[model samples]
Each structure stands twice: as structure tokens, then as C-alpha cells.
Target chain A: MEIVKKVVIAGHFGVGKTSLVSRFVHQKFSDQYLTTIGVKIDKKVIELEGATVKMMLWDIAGESSAMKIPKKYLAGAHGLFYVFDLSREETYRNLDTDLFELNKSLNGNPAIVLGNKSDLVEETFIEKLHSSIATDFKITSAKSGENVEEAFLQLAKEML
Target chain B: MNLNEIKFRPLEKKTQVIVFDQKGKVLETDNTLVEVNPEGVNIFEDTILCGMEEQFLSLKKGEQVELDCIHTDFFGKESHYDFVVMRLEEENPSYGLVIYDFGAQYNQLFDLQQERNMAQIQSHRLERENKELVDEKTTIERLYNEMKDDSSSSQYILVKADSLLYNLDFKEILYLEAYGDYIKVHTENKVYVTHNTMKRVEEILPANRFFRVHRSFIVQLSKIENIEQMSLLIRGKDKVIPIGKSYKSILLQKMDQL
Candidate 1:
């Protein structure tokens, strides 16, 4: 049987959600920042331990607030990658509330928080951010190719 | 009109209708937008439709499920649609999947959204730049204040020459000349060459005492012995510094004040 799952990459605007998708899907990185207008679907087939899963990556347009995201975009989403910019404190200050609303809309779907642009911040800053947030998040840098693949693979495995 | 001769027009021009059984199998389709498979028309082949299976199944008789802003690309041309799934009430009930193409309106909305988002990004970048400028100004003010408070440490400007730190007093310095990616600090008895720029040296020196007479030269006002045509003579030195056309008026005004 062919297993197919939908995963949505969502977060605040200018949070590098599109960059992460481009890095993971195309193995390419661009310094340009282009805003996504609507949902873009990309597919990748991952070979798991005992099963092959076709992961449909739905890169949704970022909203200023997680509650502002369209509910139609979250329909049938098996997993979600909630991303935020590491350099911007405003992006993650409301992480708890945003995650609460997003999870409510997802009906308790599995999600992973990602702090992107790790290269722009120091290790001490990352530690401070971790101490401040209640949820555990992976720090990634799409520009430097840091921990991007690992994060996507982890989410794909979780969905499986 | 006779019942067999009567026909109904579609509600939309670019529309697709797919009828499915309760088991999620495609029973019939007009094949307008959706591509048909050789074996059968399985609506589940589309990722968006496949994902909405649970929602479609939960619809009761006469109930409808709407998913808006669904995007699709056919042969390199992008299109947007609004999907409505309704369950029909009958003995052998079937489901209807109606796709209404609203690509034109959605494209307009996308353009507006793009413009708004770009403007937002520009605003954010400007805000960040403004904050950085504020921080830089604060630091410069703090340094200036600290220098002003310490009288003994304030009069001397520190310059590095040949890997040695030279503390030259403000009065002893006559002028500075720009020397190829470096500045030549001319003092009373010695000319010290330092790796610096004229603008930076001018910024560090007091505005009232030191004046930039030209693009490449900054002269101490107290050291000017005589002012000539488009040039000035420094006291105790025969060197004549050419005055820039634009700075001539400002120099004359400052000299008159002095």
C-alpha cells in the first residue's frame, strides 16, 4: 500500500518558512525574500524502515498571527512545522498562544516548532531562547543548511 | 418546454462536477478540470481531494462542506477554485463534488496580498534600521560624554603608528593629510603616519578647533598664519594647503569669527 500524508509548513510572515521548504525540497537556498500568496504543494517520497511514505508538503502563506491562517489550509494536515525567526523576539513571544490556537484548529495534530535563521544568532542566544520558551524547538538555518533536513526527516518520521 | 427538451445552464463558465458514491469512488465526472485516469476516474488521485475524504464523508444529507482557495496548476497555468461537497438525499445516496473556478478573483487577491506583504517587509526592515541607528547614536553620545567629563584624557587623540600607540595632544597637531588608505598626522616636530581616514580624524577632533579645508586635508584653525587665494599658510611651516572651492566661504566665516 502507498502511504501518503499532508504536512503544512506555517508560521509568521518573513519567518523563512518558504526558504526552509526550498532548501529541503530543492536543495537550494536564496537570499531573496519572496512572500507566498497561497498554498503551494510539493511532494517527496521518503523511504522509512518498513514503509515508503509519499509526503505532500503544503507550504502555506504565512500570517502575522497563527489564528489568522485559513482553516481550509489546515484541513487533513497530518503534521505541521510551526516556524519562527530566531533573531526576532516578536515572532516567538506569542508561541504558546499561537500553538494553542493552531492545535485547536488541527484537532491535536502532531507539530514541531522550528526556530529558523540560527546562523544569525549566537549559541548563548539560542540557549536563552530555549530557556524562555516552554516548548522544545529545533534551531535551523536554511541559508547555511543547518539542521533543515534533519527537521523535515524527523517530522516525516513522526507522521509515519 | 417538454421535459426531455429542457436543459439547464451551468452556474459558472469554468466549472467541474464530479459525482462520487458513498464509498468515495468517482461515479461520474464531466472531466472539465480534473484529468481522468485510463482505468477509472478516482477523485482520490488529487492530493487535495484525497486529504478532504474524511470531511466529505462526514457530510449528512443536504449538508455541504466548503473548502475555499484551493489552488491547482494545469499544464503550467495556475488556477484557483472553491470546492463544495454535498451529500444527496436518496435511496442510494451519492455525494457531489462541485468545483467552481474563481481564478481571476483569486489572482487579483494574490497580487494585493503580495503588495501588502512586500510593504510590510519594507516597514520591518526600516524599523530595524531605525533601531540600529538609535543604538549607534546612543553609544556615540555616551562615548562623547565620557570623553568630555575626563579633562586630562580628552585633549589627547590616540593614533597608532608602526605598531606603536602615539598620544598626540590637540594643540601640537598642525594638520592631517590623506595618504593612500592612511592619514599623515603632522605635528610640530614629527609627522606620524597612521592607518586611518580623514573623515574619521575630523570626527574625533573638536569641530571648533579642527576644520576640514579640503577633501584630503584637515587643518587646525589655530595654526593658520595667513590666508591666500584658494590656499592657506600654516604657522611655522612653509607648506600651503589648497582650500576647496566649497569650503572657502566656510573657512572665511570661521576665520572672521575667530
Candidate 2:
């Protein structure tokens, strides 16, 4: 039996969710930011611990609040990757509330919070952000392909 | 026209129809645009369809559910579709899936949305840049004010002469004297003449340190040694500056005396 899991990539507008998915799935990165309409699905197969896992990544349209996301798009999701641009403070300033609402829909599904665009920010800024937020997040860069694979694999491992 | 002679036109080529049982097993297909799997065609193969099973199950006979912007790559080509599922009014009560290929329209919308999003991001970036510039300007102005305050006692006035500029220290000046079209700046060591007026020189000097005692003379307060009834003598200088009758009272009020 093939283990297939649906994972959702969600965040505010222009948060690099699409870029992260493209970098991880296709090993391609683009500087152009074209907004996602509705949902775009991409599949990737990865080997972990002697098991093959097929992950269906659903890139949902961006909304300012998690509650504004279409419930259907998040339905039957086994994992979630909540991404935010590190250089934009407004993207994650209300993270506490956004995470609370997103978790309510997940029903205890595994989620990884990612602060993307690490190349645009300084190391001190990343340190300060870690101290200010209550949740733990991994710093990744879709442009530099830093930690992108690890984050997806980590979520896939947790989902399995 | 007779009922037997009447003919109906076929549906558009882009539209595909598939009939499925309640368990999502495809029983019949009238597909022209999409390629069907040789073994089977299951609605469960589409994740979106699986997600919408509840809505499909509750749909009554003759009632249909519509889902827009459904994406599929089943034809070996990426395409967008709008799907309509209707519960058939039959003995077996099967479901009919009508899929319309709307790739052209969806692509148009995608292009428009892409432009709007890019424009918004550009506007946001410009706003951030403008705010940073404003903050930098304010910081520079603050530092300039603080530096000006710190060096208040040792300020220099730039005096232009012939082809050179001179930074005359305020403490070294004895007094300013008007000479026709120019003002002579006398210091402890020398007298430097520049084309200026006493009135303009008074305004440039610090009000607390320099005072206008006469129409032609603006003396440094610290350079005054002795004040007589009609004139004042400069410290360490033999020259005496005449005090104007109209300016005597105010000049006396400005000086410290017992």
C-alpha cells in the first residue's frame, strides 16, 4: 500500500509559499511573484526510513487571516507548512492568533512554521525573532535553497 | 416538423460527461477532450472530488453542485476545468459528472491576478523604502542639532576674502567696525577686513556673546575691559569704541554691573 498524504502550504499574501513549494518539488526558483488562484497541487515522492511517501502539496491562495481561508482547501490535510516572510513583520506579527485558528482546522495535524527569505535578513534579526515569538520556527530560504528539503521532509516524517 | 424528423445538435466538444455509481465507479463516459484510463475511471482518483464527497452525496435528483477552477493534468496536458455533478433521476440513481474545459478563461484570470499581486508588492516595497528614508532624515537632523549644542562656545564664522575663506574664531575678535562698504574684524593679533555690514555681522554672531554698542561697532562682550560715560575700551587694546547715545541704555542694561 502506498502512503499518500495531503499537505497544505498556507500563509499571508506574497509570503513565498509557492516559491518554497517550487524549490522543494522542482528544484527551481524564480524571482517573479505570481499570486496563486484557488489551489495548485504538486506531488513529490521521498524516501524516509526505508519507506516511500507520496506527498500531495496543496498551495492555497493567500489570505490575511487563517479564518479567511476556504475550509474546503484545508479539508483532509494530513500536514501543514505555515510560511511567512522574515523581512516583513506584518506577515507574522499576529502569529499567535493565526496559529490558533489554523490549528483548530488541523485537528492536531503536524505543522511546521517556516520563516522564509533568510537571505534578506541578518542573523541578529533571526535571533531576535526567535526570542519574540512563542512558537519555534525553522529559518529557510527558497531563493538559496536552504533548509527547504529538510522542512518538507520533517513535515512528511511527522505526518507519517 | 414531425417529431420523428426533428434532430438535436451535439454538445460542444470541450464538454465531457461521465456517469458513475454511488461508490464512484465510472459506468459510462462520453469524453472527447479528456483521456480516460483504459482500466477504469474513478472519481476518487481526484483529491478534490474526494474532498467534495459529502456535498455530492447530499445532492438531490435534478439538483447539481458546481465547482470552479478545478485543475487537472489527466490528458497529459495541464488544464483548468469547471465541474458540475448532478444526481441522476434513475432507478439506480447514478451521478452524472459534466466537466467543461475552461483553460483559456482561467489563464486570462490568472494573468490578471498575477499583475495585480505584483503591483501590490511593488507598492508595499516602495512604502517601506519611503519610511526608511524619512527615519534617516530625522536621525540626521537630530544628530546635527546635538552637535551644534555641544560646540556652542567655540563656533567659527566663515569670512570670505579675495580668493580664500577664513574661519574666524569668535573668541579672538575684538570688535567689528563699519568702513564704508566693508566691515573690519579686529582680533588680538590682526585686523581682517571683509565686505560686510555691521548689522549683518551682529546677526551672525552669538547674541549672548556679542553686542552692538554703537551703529558701527559690534563688540564681543568678553573683550570689553572698561566702560566710561561715552566710550568702552577693549581688553588688552588701546583703542576705545564710542558708544552711541541711542544704544547706551540698552547696552548698559545688557552689561553686568553692581
If scored against the real structure, what TM-score would every candidate get?
Answer: 0.68, 0.72
Displacement of residue B22 (Cα, Å) in model 2 is 7.2
- Candidate 1 stretches with Cα past 4 Å from truth are A30-32, A119-128, B1-10, B74-77, B89-93, B151-258
DockQ of candidate 1 against the true complex: 0.32
DockQ versus reference, model 2: 0.41
**lDDT of each residue in B1-258, candidate 2, tens digit only:** 111111122544577777777777776665576666525656755434653456677778778877666665645657777777888755676787777788888889989888887777678788889999999999999998777656656788888776568898888889999999899999899788899888888888877778899999999988999999989999999999999999889888888899
lDDT of 2 by residue, A1-160 (tens): 4576889898888989989999999999999887877777777889887787878888887777898887867767889999998988878978878888888879899999999999999999999999989999999999999999999999988998
Candidate 1 per-residue lDDT, tens place, B44-146, comes to 5554565556777777787888877766553244677777777764557677777777889888887788788878877877888899899999999999877
